[model samples]
Target: MRVNADFTKRVAVHFDRNDWIASPAAGVERKMLDRIGEEVARATTIVRFAPGSAFAAHTHDGGEEYLVLDGVFQDETGDFPAGSYVRNPPTSSHTPSAKEGATILVKLHQFDPEDRTEIRRSITGDSNLQLFKDSREDVRVLNLSPGEKLDLDAVDGLELFVIAGSVQESDEEFSVWDWLRLPPGARSTALAGAEGARIWIKSGHLSQMI
Candidate 1:
């Protein structure tokens, strides 16, 4: 199964709650944005857990990354509220659930084979611009007020995902969980909507494996 599988081309979409389809798990559902392979695959999705829902303990042979969008996500490690970002490197294992329910944006099997660092960050503070740096890439979250514009430099494989409100790229507008990916050497700027915008930006990734 594949959705937006072309790595050389740009793919974009707005996440719709109605598009969520229940997974094999009783109360867990997902809105798949891109995927390749069967049950165990390279994929990106927005997942939701109904109250009391839980997933069995499992190992990620490739890797896993996620950002909590709403409610709380819990595991043996601790409880993570909305605006939390977590990265479980290749071969990591965990049992994840939501007691109060939750919605999250997640990526599976997308890490470089040698990149095994574990990361967890809180994004619940006041809205602002922040960066997450790594030898392989730089990730940034921009919280922009109405009519605000943020300049983005050209880089190799730029990826943008609008988490909330609205953002404009060039003259194009995106809203509510829209996604976009650009190739190396691409340049651009983003502008916020009247209500403000919160966006996640990351770059310096191998496009072929995406």
Candidate 2:
């Protein structure tokens, strides 16, 4: 059940080109990127929900994080449209579905026990973003133009997943569904494509490994 389970090595994979494997839920399919357990394992995957599809209520003992890639995702809280980022803390439960269908980049069972913050962000709203700079870190979640590079300080690491367009690191290229994880103290630059790019990035989290 281990796919790209090695933490020390750099891993990059294109999800759009991968096969869509059916999940246990009816009308739900997933493109597994990395997995390490059985049905309720620590895993990262790209999931798609067919129209009128829904999943049974379930609890995430280890937590869940997801970004809506296309269409809308629904739960008891509300509906999350494309470009939304959500995190459900440990021991949280929900029954998720989509009437018009949806696609999401989902990460499960990968959270620090002490990090108990729940977040839901809608990129469409202007108040959801802020620009700040400091001596140790520079953080922002907005538009990134082509050839623009972000330098994460040595104390932290960089993790980015492309929401749209394309991203290139070293010789590896990632499209919409691709993901990149740089190790601690690792230096990497991203170049967006002609269509520009939108990305979700998290820094200062390399030490917290699952």
- Candidate 2 weakest lDDT stretch, 10 residues: 130-139
Tens-digit lDDT track of model 1 for 70-168: 999988888989989998889999999999999998889987777778878887655664446666667778788999988766466777888788988
Off by over 4 Å in 2: 125-142, 152-157
lDDT of all the models against the reference?
A: 0.82, 0.75
| Candidate 2 per-residue lDDT over residues 79-131, each given as its tens digit | 99997878888888999999999999898987765556688876654232532
Q: Which candidate is the best by TM-score?
A: 1
Best prediction by lDDT: 1
Model 2 has an lDDT value of 0.75
Least well predicted 10-residue stretch by lDDT in candidate 1: 124-133
